[model samples]
Target: MPLCHLLQFVTSVVSCSPAELKLDNNGKKEKVKGFNVILKDTILFPEGGGQPDDHGTIEDLPVVRVLRQGAEAVHFISSALEEGREVQLKVDWERRFDHMQQHSGQHLITALADKMFGYKTTSWELGRQRSSIELDTASVKPGEMEALEDAVNNRIRDHVPVNVRLLSIDDPDVEKVRSRGLPDDHAGPIRIIDIEGIDTNMCCGTHVSNLSHLQVIKILGTEKGKKNKTNLIFIAGNRVLKYAEKSYNTEKLLTSLLKTGPDEHVDAVDKLQKTVKRLQKSNLTILRDMAVLIAQNFKSQPARGDFFSLHNKDGDNEFMNIIANEIGFQDTIIFLTVGEEKGAGLFLLAGPENVITELGPRVVELLQGKGAGKNGRFQGKANSLAKRAEVEALLQKHSCRRAAGEE
Candidate 1:
């Protein structure tokens, strides 16, 4: 198919066609029959300039990824497109303009940082909801971010006209640009983002042609970055409204839960947490006292050196431990197991080491469980306590055999 590149503004909606279509995974060359389209010429911006690509549609089919391959843009689609077919390329204007605001806002910020604070923006990234710039300085002082934002936002409110122009590498205005020279792989004409009187810089990302298009510039926060650099995280355009809405909703929820205004929510939460700790301590003491009372109730059950205690306590291992400790000190064997219908826990402590060594495995086997121990103290988990009564009888039966030494 014959192909030609479109000469259109960054915001233009393009009419194009598939110059050639084939299955092109990022690296895999398998013949997948879907998920990519290659347009002859498109207004959709590819991934570049610390900014991401635009996602829209080609002939109403969703275009998921727009990648820059040399001078051409490769469009990845959800469905395969036929060669030379008419396709209308549309840019998601809302998202596209969001990128424009952030990308252009970055240029203004980087320019002013160098102008006012001598801090340079070395690199940046455009993210789904947030964007950040890595500064050349070792660290940004706590107080400097406010001043940086103030200056950047002042420029945005001024509504400075922006210009995009193609220049030859030999043009004298090249020296007036910020940062280093053109990229090593510079192709065609050099594109410069000229921000009125604020700054001029080289960038491949699509940006708003006017500064006021960036509704606002807000400094979200900052952090220490790689190699002693500082990163300033920020949002622009409609995201400023979005970030504020989300923050307000969160604050509203916190205030409601704490039964206080936003100003006192933290103190309210602190008091609530302290009160919970006190209640937890009180409950633990009550459970221990209850366990002791339960031991007294079962202390008189008679057997031939055989003791069995079963309780369905929802796998409270600590309660099981307390019961075993209270009654297991006597001169007899004990299988104090607690559990529910699905599973159970066993804590075995016996007066005779040989008796437990022999009987513990059988009890575990009866319940289809797993456990191990020596010196007549064993602990394990079991699949079922349904046979607890049978298992209890087995313990009593084993005690009789062990006492008689009938092996």
Candidate 2:
């Protein structure tokens, strides 16, 4: 059987050397001047038991991954160590401790969730930023969530011992364990993690010696997961502090933008949205009336067989449609109306068939934009509004040439 690389059994000094590494895609050992080394044993836990492998350095080369194959633990590396030579191994203590705290906290939370609400954890993922466990239920109510959190935190604050006991399959203690069950293949020894006066469960993942190391457990939220399960997202230890800091910074930014304290931000945003909606309605009324006046002005002017233009920053497709339809209803005059609102530019042209045919492509080409229309009307979006002035100038010049030709 492969030796379990437990932190409790190994020290910083090891007699291991470059043991074995996986090959690259080309069916040969990578020549990238790196060693695939494993210790005679390791303090770094191989990825298993729903927890990730421990990250650290062996003989000064960074360990990429510690994977288990059959009965042996394999540690992939960035570079190789001398074969059969002694080396130093260092586990990233901060990372290890963080995993320990999270794994232990999960055990406590999972136990209490079952005991109090009968919600069994179906599965769990140990993530770097946040960890999550899927509970075997379709829905998790807010009150149930609060109760679970309170119960879990109550255990953590109690500073109870989290002891590990190794036992055979036939051990009486195995029956006492609150376990999902043993694997179908069956194993040699089962490592049972027992939380004092709480629960005992079979787990291979590392854990804190005590619950106080958990520091704190925060249930971020939950979502419906696969097969009608509820995925509970959580963070523990320093991660909770980091998450709190990020949330605080985001709220502070919202406070600045809304000009309100965090407590009043919702009300302020609601009022701001209502105010904006009213202003938009008022602006649309003014622009529609202006479009009417402009159409009348162009109608009152002497017929100029050239394209005229109107610009409105606040105009929309509907407003442009009203303006274009209003003026061209009476004369053979071709006009260009443009608006650049919210950094998007739009244009419309209508008039004599020849003018629309000639000017449409010229306008689109000038802006390097996209447009398509037929029967004396064409419009399209520009790549950007920055080139609107250049496109409009080209329209003016084209219209002048067409007028000259007509003369």
Candidate 3:
């Protein structure tokens, strides 16, 4: 039987000892305390060759991770089994098969891309949702993407056999195959994946024996990568079905909300976006006019208050600035707030330079905000507007004291 299918193995434990394993999860290095178990033989494939580690059980104890340390496949498990004791190993076939499909699909795409477009895959990733191959070219045209997809799917339908060969470094055939060089601590026979008449490449990742097992390959599309490179995204096997189901559900939801068919959904969304933009333009015009009128009314008041203050729930920093600009701060202190009545928002304070400088930090502390200012104007994001009344009182008290001092 092929080694990949040897999920059930009765092997003696070579060693089992307490150890701390550091693993990079989502760009974060995390330390896991476990026992490193080396078996006489292992079916679990360690993370390498752009493929992830296999998840399985070691004597019914869950193997958290498997890593290749030179020639040894070390298994990390929560508990330890006695050294030299024989134990049964089981592989999570579902996870293993998914990885196989993605890895093999990647090979098919990479090979065809190089053959058809002369775009060599510089690197590839088997992501959780989809896989991507970074092509050395600056861009891939839409027509080329379509043709590549057709070619890969054709190979899948052809039921081409995927053969694995173990060759020594000195073997003449090793020179014929595509290689990216071996690891620094590599040893023993080098494994090569041959896609019948399609291509042969040096790789250590597990693959499906037949191309037909891939079921289908869907080239989702491409995205701009680093300079002179493009990332071609794709999904294969069950992932294609899952993606289709999710997309259909989203379409149905959009259809219900949009009251239109899938074909008209894009047009409907575009029309709504244009309308929103027009309304936003009109709203801005109205806010500017209103800011001027508000200042005029405050100045025309029969008995003007000690300080002027206003809060607009639907306003923003620009609106507050417009109001402050209209109401000059020569002899008046203006406290303008734009946001929710008693929640987070923005605050603007403009008055004498010395007064604003003295009050800016205190206001920021009260509202749990951070801001900077020069001259006389101070503005910032206000996290808590619940203290707006207290801020107004402080401004009024200081204004009163300043007025008395001037008198």
Q: Which candidate is the best by lDDT?
A: 3
Tens digits of lDDT, candidate 3, 1-407: 66776678788999999999887899999998889999998889998989999999977999889999998899999987898898999999888989999999999999999989899999999998999999999998769999999999999999999999999999999999997789998989999999999989999998999999999999999999998899999999989999999999999999999999999999999999999999999998888888889888888888785578999888878888877777788678899998888889999999888989999999999999888887899999999999999999999999999879963
> Which regions of candidate 3 are displaced past 4 Å?
5-41, 57-67, 73-90, 341-343, 403-407
Question: In angstroms, what RMSD does candidate 3 have relative to the true structure?
Answer: 3.2
Residue 382, model 3, lDDT: 91
Cα lDDT, model 3, residue 72: 89
Question: What is the descending TM-score order?
Answer: 3, 1, 2
Cα deviation of 236 in candidate 3 (Å)? 1.0
Best candidate per TM-score, number?
3
Select the stronger candidate by TM-score from 1 and 2.
1
User: For residue 162, what is the lDDT in candidate 1?
Assistant: 85
The number of residue pairs in model 1 that clash at the backbone is 1
TM-score of 3: 0.87
RMSD of each: 7.9, 7.3, 3.2
- When 1 and 3 are scored with TM-score, the better candidate is 3
